[model samples]
Structure formats: C-alpha cells, structure tokens
Target: MQHTDKSLQRKVNFLLYYAVISTSIFLVFILSSFVGKDKNLTADEITVKRITVVGEDNLPRMVLSNETRQHSGRMEGKEFPKRERPAGIIFFTNKGDECGGIVAATTAKDGSVNHGMSFTMDNYHDDQVIQLLNDETYENGKAEVSRGLMFNEYPVGSNLNDRMAKTEELKKIADPKEREAKIGELWDKEGAKRRMFIGRNVNADAGVFLYDAKGKPKMKIYVDKAGNPKIEVRDSTGKYKNIIQQ
Candidate 1:
C-alpha cells in the first residue's frame, strides 16, 4: 500500500510538469504572434511614375503618365511619330485608338522660361481636330502669352492611317523637291484646315477669327492693344470688305 501511494504521487508530479510546459508553450506562441507580425499600414499619399487603367480585356484604356514613358499614339495599321511629350493623360477610344489627351509642360532653362497646356480631341486615325491651348513664354526679356480655342478640319472620308501610307509613297520619288511638293499637295488634299480661332493673341488682344472651309479668314472681331474694338468682314480671299469700329 505504501509503494502504491509513492507511485501515484510520482504520476501526479509528472502530470503537473507536463501541464506547466504546455501552458508555457501556448503563452510563448501567443506573444510571438503579436510581436513578429507586421503592423497595419497607413499612408497619406502614394507616389508613382505612371499608372495605366485597363479595360476588362486587360488592354490599356487610359494612362496617366510622364514624358519619358509616354505611350506613343496607337493606330492599328499605321506607324506614327514616337516623340517624347510632356506629362499628360492619354485616353483610348472604344476601338483601341489613341483618341485624345491633355498635356502640359514647363521649362526654365538657359534664361528662357516657357510653359503650355493643350487639351485636344482627335479624329479617328488622325491628329487633333480641336484644341484648347494656353502658352506663355519669356525669352530675351520679353514675355508672350496666348490662350485660345482652335478648330481644324479632318478629311471627311479619309483615315489618318491611309494618309500616313500616302506619305510613304511620296518618299519613293527620286527628286527631293518633287517629293516635298507631292507631300504638301497630299496634306492640302487630306489634312484638316484650321477653320476657327478665338481668344487672346500674343499681343494680349482678344479676337475671334473665322475661316472658310478653305481656311481663309473671312471675319475678325477683335480688341486692339489700344483698347479699340473692331469688326472686320473679309471676302473669301481674306480681302477686307468692311470694317466696323467701336
């Protein structure tokens, strides 16, 4: 009976030891989980060089990007100018073409300062047909600023890609002048004519200039630098036909 009591006491001591070890391990695990884990993140601003918003098809639909990484304008069957541009937002059309964008730039170098912004809408397969723009420049101790809205024509039935292809064909001409003349003719035949202008000119004068389809200025209403307001009507040849002043 004494031997049984001793063995039972030993068993009880062993159980207590086991329980202590298990509890210690659980406590250690809980502490380590709290201490070794990362804290919840909080931030006020996130900076990035470029961001592209893609459509459901995983194709880029809009891009907010910088100059160096600017997306070259996309045309399905044609190649286009791939030049560096200012920081801007470029948007793609439903057909996956580069359709429009707003871009701005500022430069202060070599004692000259200049900045500008343009908001443009492009025609299919073509360049900008409408633009709102403001540009300011200071050079040689002179400053010039102009803010304006402009409208240009897009060939009614021609795709821009086809026009680009025509330019390539012009290059096959052996004579440089002949190629240039042909190119100019092609542009005149297919390019959008600047048909309207309204806003402040470089002289800081306000004006509205209206052009005919052939791009001849047919009417002008303006305030001159001397604060004189005038309305000038012109013939299709840009010859002044009448002048009204106030």
Candidate 2:
C-alpha cells in the first residue's frame, strides 16, 4: 500500500508541473500577440516650424519653412555668406548642394514685397551655368511691380571656393574706397549676364529682350500695355538702328 501511495503522489506532482509549463507558454503567446498588434493614430491638425526631407542616405534633399527657419543653402560643409531669406522651399542636389529654390518675402523697412522661383544647373563645380526663373518685386506706392521670366548665365570661375575666399578677404579691408574697388574686381571676375528676358518690365511694358554675351540687350520685341507693338533692331554693339511699329 505504501509503495502504491508513493507512486500515485509522484504522478500527481508530474501532472501539476506539466499544467504550470503549458499555462506559462499560453500566457507568453497572448502577451506577444498584444505587443505585435498595429497601432493607428489620428489627429485633427498638426503644425510645425520647418520640415526637412532626407534622402536614402539620410542627407537633406529638401526643406520647407518660414523665413526664420529658411535654410541658407549650406552645402559640402561650406556655408555661403548671406543673410536670412524669406519663407520658401529650398531644394538640395544629390551631392548635398543647393540646386535651386522658391522664396518670397515682405519687408516693412524697405516697403517692398518680392517673390521668386528658380532652378539652376551646376557647371564646373559652381552653380549658375543655366537658370530658369520667374521673379517679381513690388515697392510701396509703386505704379507697377517688376515681374519677369529671366534666363541668366553667371561667368564661371576656376574655383568657387577660392573666389569666395577672396571675397571674404576683401571684406576685411579697412578703407571703404579700397573695399569698394575690390568688390568691383570680384564682380568683374564672375559677373552675372542676363541672356534672355521675356516678361513685363517695371514700366508696364511686355517684351522679349535678347542680350549679348557682354550683357547688352541686342534685340527687343516690345509691346506697351496700350497694345502698341514695336520691333527694335540693334547693332553688334547694341546700338539701335531701326524700329518697326505696329
């Protein structure tokens, strides 16, 4: 009888152990299912100061924000020396450079408002080989705002960084006159040339102005707001020869 009782007790203990193990496993699986469940979020409104979109390698490709939050077009770890621009979207190249952007601003001090959208292509390691732009600027109490589509070409330099460094060095000059001369020299080295303009001028005239490499308007197809049209022919030196009116 003692032997039989001992065997029965051993069987009961084994059954209890099995029940505990199974119960533990079942509880673990239930907890895991809850943890893996999807969570959905809903919101009525969300506001942010600025948003930066990152590329595959986690580098910034684009940014959207207000003036204070506007990106300064910093690229390749080099910062361009400039002030805060108005609110707009700034785009970055795949190589993390400032390719182009759309910006607008209103200033009380200048009593002016302006907006511009532009796209640029890089050449010789510097931007401004070709530019497509739509820009407008209005001054307080002005008769008409200046708005236009412009194609521009900035003279290329051997090195952008070197030229920028030279500019910074020039800024350190103590004499204002000397600094001004140096500034002119800098511009002469990399002056921007307007190749074409097709839009309304500030004088309320709509026209197409074709320019020469020296930034001279060589030919013009002009039309006033009054519907008067004229074609002006110019010489190689941009001297006007004849005007055909319609």
Candidate 3:
C-alpha cells in the first residue's frame, strides 16, 4: 500500500510540473503578440522643429518656431546685420527635395532694397537676376535679364534687307508669276519657323527681347514674382500662343 501511495504522488507531481510549463509557454506567446502589433510610425512622419543657418563672418544661427520648414522639410528667412559698408544682406533657405523660396534683398549704402529688385529662384530653369556692381557700394548698377529656352542654339532666319534683296533678285530672273511662286517656297522653307533664346538673368528690372532675323520683335518676356521670366508668344493672327514660365 505504501508503494502504491508513492506512485500516485509521483503522478501528481508530474502533472503539476507539466501544468506550470504549459502556462509559462502560453503567457510568452501572448506577450509576444501584444508587442509585435503594428505601431504605424515612419521616418517621413517625423517633423523638423528647427533649422540652423550658416553664413560668412557670423556664428551659426538657429531659427526656431517655423512651421513652413516642417511641412516642406526646409527653412528660409532674412537677416540684416549691422556692419561696415558694402555688407551683404543675406537670405537663406534650408535644403530639401522642394526647398522653400529665397528672399534675397540687396541693399545700398543706406540699407534699402536696391533698385526695387528682389532676387529669387523657385525652380531649376527660372532666371535669377543678379546685380553686377562696379563696387560693393552698388553704385552705377546696370540691369540685365535673361530668358530660358529649350534649344541649345538659336536658329537663323532671313533679315528684312536680305528678304528685300532676294525679292529683287528673283524679279530679275523670272516673270512675276514664277517669282511669286518661288518667294512662297522660300518663305515656307525659312520664314515660318521660330528660334530659341536661352540666357541667365544678370540684374533686376532688365527685359529680354526676342527678335526674328528680320529684327522684328517676336516676344517680350519679363521676370515674375519668383524671379523667373515668363515668355508670352502670339500667332500671326494676333492670338496668344502660350505662356512659358520657368
């Protein structure tokens, strides 16, 4: 009877040990499931709270509390520091995929926005007007503006004098009927096409003019608010072709 009692107690101990081990395994699986659920946080979702600007002759300055930089992942602002003559008024914007706009204000000796021109660049192809001064005082400044076009080189067309000379030469060679036909063919071959103009803006308030080989005005483009020139074209019948903005 004592031997039987020892065997039953052994079975009870074995069952208790198995119960504890099973409970531990179940608890571990439950805990792992709770920790592994998706939290839904990404790197792009994090915001940049501040931006640090660095420039010449100045310590690094941090501009805080700007929400514009947070959304676009960049920062831009203006700083006017009191210093000696010919000091530059620097405008800065931080780096990102689509960075913020730049507000470059060039000041004269009196610290005013020089000649009412603000230099800026919004995109890659936009024309940026940069002032060329004789000295740092910004005296005797000249304005030069440029427009961007697609082609690498500008095409050539007939000049007014050359067209007139061609007409005269054709009259001498053929009858009026044949001369008119030849002139039409020449116009179709050379006169109907347009030329491309590409250049960078050198100064503000400067206008870029596009002319045909005949020295006639083809288009007049001006700089926009973002410091980029807007090109306006017209058809022969005076209808608008399209506005090209850089």
Best by TM-score: 1
Candidates sorted by lDDT, descending order?
Answer: 1, 2, 3
Colliding residue pairs in candidate 1 = 153-192
The residue ranges of model 3 lying beyond 4 angstroms of the native Cα positions read: 1-174, 190-192, 198-220, 223-230, 233-237, 241-246
Global lDDT of each candidate: 0.85, 0.73, 0.44
Across 64-167, the per-residue lDDT of candidate 1 in tens digits comes to 99898887777773335888788999988766678889999999999999999999999877888889999999999899999999999876876788888899
**Model 3 residue-pair collision total:** 0
Off by over 4 Å in 2: 1-45, 110-140, 156-160, 235-239
What C-alpha lDDT, on a 0 to 100 scale, does residue 112 get in candidate 2? 70
TM-score: the better of candidates 1 and 3: 1
Model 1, global lDDT: 0.85
Model 2 scores worst on lDDT over the 10 consecutive residues at 120-129
Q: Arrange candidates, best TM-score first.
A: 1, 2, 3
Quick one: how many clashes does candidate 2 have?
A: 0
Give a tens-digit lDDT track for model 3, residues 64-108.
Answer: 324333222222222223233221222333332222132223455
